[model samples]
Target: MKYDFIVVGHGLAGAILAETLRSRGSKVLVIDEPKENSASRVAAGLLNPVAGKRFAKSWLADAFIPAANAFYEALEARYGQQLFFHKPIYKIFSSIEEQNTWMAKSAGDNWGDYILATHTQSINQPGIDDPFGGIMIGRGGFLHVYALLDLLTEDLLKQELYLPERFDMDELQLTESGVKYKSIAADQLIFCEGYQVVHNPYFKWLPIQPTKGEVLEVQAEQNFSPECIYNKAVYVVPEGAGRFIIGATYDWRNPDEEPTPQGQEELSERFRQITSKQFKVTGHWAGIRPAVRDRRPLAGTHPKYKQLSVFNGMGSKGVLMAPYLAQRFAAALAGEEEVMPEIHIFRYLSLYYAYTDQQNQQP
Candidate 1:
């Protein structure tokens, strides 16, 4: 079999890239072995405009938000499935000082577009108490990641474009013309292997500070509406029908992809802080996010092998970042425009080579 591109890994990165390439009339073969603990599959799919302790508007939020909306809307129309939902995020303020900090930050010109001037009065939900702080953020919501992945997988299967198997690097050959797989040939091969990039022989030198995040699903009371996703120390995302997905504890030291008892306990404790109602833990899962040291996505082709490329390192923001970057990556692959210098793999080429040289020199 021949294809214009062979994409390894069918997670969010691979799926979005494959779809983008196929939409451009290119033949693409997606090879993947769905890890039981892959991040995308378990992602809460929260897209927040403001992030972190400072409540800073996400980097490139102005562009990324609109692009994300357009991309998901188009996907929903094409697949006849709802992939994105607009839900205002209710950020709870823990203290008066925190509320003051948010208000101070909101007054800035750069933050004006993303933050609201006044606190929200509508409590939306009754069980959770918020006394000191409240804010309704616009242009933030949840992507139905699981449903989107399922829809994409089904569509790819229907089109005979998906291969459900692990890609053995040993079987790959870099030919003079291009890369060769078992029997398939491609003009270019790209790896969207997510956090597993640490295992890629070619890209291992790229500094990926991967982090393990754990989340839990709890059965909530029937009164809470599934309209909004609540966020504070932990986020409570409504999963419909008296169930809410709560979680996320970031652990950089323990990078394993398995859920731990401590992680579950931490999450449950955080949940209890926000609500008095008793809830039962229905599910718990953990995944490794392919976070970079500088917290920006890595893209573009290998320095030594132009035919090989990578589109990984969207980190925690894969839901918001994948679509736009996938389009840009496709353009870069097609040689339509120069890849963004800041995010290109070439930015770290010298450091990577030096590291590899050091490894070779070591006993």
Candidate 2:
């Protein structure tokens, strides 16, 4: 078998990359071993334009947001399934100072565009504690992560472009002209293995800090608005019916996917702080996010092996970052453009060279 590219992993990054490549008329094959704990499977699919405690606009919101919306919308239309839901995110102000800060920012130029309107009343109904009021944000919502992955996988299977198997590095042979992995030959091999890249001998030197996060699905007695996301100490987004998705707890020390008692208690405490309503915890999920020290995605071909490339490290922002970044990567692969300087794999060449020099000298 031969292809223009062999993409490892079927997560959002890999799926979007494969789709983009195929749209450009390239032959692509995707190899993935399904994992019960892959981050994409466990993601809440939150795409917020303004995030974090300071409520700063997300990095490159202008570009990433529209690209993401268009990408997800296209996927939804092709598959005849509802995947992306455009909803407003109502952020509960934690303090009077925070409320004042939003007021000032809302008066600013770009911030005003993102700021739909401010409310002085509690939008949480009876269960939520929003005495300081909340602000509704625009151009942000959630993606049905698992549904999108499943639909994409089905399409690849029908096209005979997907292989449900693990890619073994031992079976791979890097030739002068291209790469050979088992029976398949390709001009280039791109790895989008997410946090599992730690095991890839060829690209393991890339610093990928995998953090474990946990989220819960619960049925609360109160009716939260399904059209908007309620946030404060913890987020409770209505997931149809009487169920709401409450997430998420971040832990750097542990990478295990099993829900922890500590994580549950912490989330419960935060949920309580945000809402006074009682809820029944029905489900819990955990997965590792592929974060980086510098907080930028890693893309582009290897310094030593031009035929090998990587596109990973979107971390918690995978929903917002994947589409646009994948398009850029696909363009670079087609030789139509170059990867951005900031997220380019060349940013870590110094470390790669240092590691190579040390290894050669030791042997």
Candidate 3:
């Protein structure tokens, strides 16, 4: 095989992993099929560590956030493109209890430098509906995920390391050495096909519960500063040029990327709940997130085939976690380190066994 590894899908996870491997001197070929509703393309790409109604910090936030910033910074330096932003996020307190919790956490210096400013009263931003006040979190921001993907795709194409085609499983042939797909052979193949992995015969048992989400790009009457992100029930991210990204509505039952009226209404209402700003709905888009049952990434080699592997299930925290996890996975693939056990594929080995057993019983 001419390629050391072949990566399927060019979304956020796949692109990062391929780049990590290439940086470590591995010959990589990335095959991608363009999906209009790719989550990475439409993602708001927040880098926030503080999350949820509970106002608790994200898991490994202190570690992952810095890794992501450094990774994106390196990419920007190489590509000469601004792919990352270091905007402060203002999380509006929903109730007194949440505000008090922040107070307690702040007293313990739990947030470190990530906490920029805490207002006992409203942050005093115009049009904001923060009656209880808000917390400005620093050392975090958002990633230009779409831009990063485009830059990587262009680079791959220039180097003849990228193939633009849909992966057809029927054409795949596993061998004693590795595997071949449509005459292209590699030492190993990793699948990062996102929510579509359910259709992959080899990875059928991966517990990826696809969740459909919709986001709206609204044109605010007053331009929101790109230096800050506002969060309430949902997040309102400034995209420069008076455009803001208001999202997202989560639907697990239908994992397709079809934008609906209900989603638009829900997003619009949620934005209203955070502020009294009127904005024109400029764009509406949707994508399916490859959220796992346990809310963690899925990595490591296949149980039955050493030549096959998967690197996906980024879920909602892709922007914050992908870079760190990608490097970790690359090291694991090279046998230089062990993959995070909590997210290793072996965790779901029983699911694969049960699936195979059912198939055998049917015959």
TM-score of each: 0.95, 0.96, 0.97
**Model 2 C-alpha lDDT per residue in residues 64-164, reported as the tens digit of each score:** 98899889888878877889888888899888888888778666656756888888666546666888898888888888889899999998999999999
Winning model by TM-score: 3
Q: Model 3, range 15-35, lDDT digits (tens) per residue?
A: 999998999999999989877
Worst window of 10 by summed lDDT in candidate 1? 113-122
Candidate 2 deviant stretches above 4 angstroms: 120-124
Model 3 TM: 0.97
- In candidate 3, residue 158 scores what lDDT? 97
Error of 1 at 66 (Å): 1.5
Residue lDDT tens for model 1, 1-363:
889999998888888889899989999999999676788888889898888677788887887888889889998998888878788787888778888888787767466545543563436367776776577777888888878888888888888888889999999999888899999899899999988889998888888877899999999776666767777799888878888888688999999988999999999988887777788999999998889988889998887887789999988798888888888889988989888876898889887889789989999
Ranking by TM-score: 3, 2, 1
* lDDT (Cα atoms) of all candidates against the true structure: 0.84, 0.86, 0.88
Candidate 1's TM-score: 0.95
Estimate candidate 2's RMSD in Å: 1.5
- CA lDDT of 294 in candidate 1? 82
Candidates sorted on lDDT, descending: 3, 2, 1
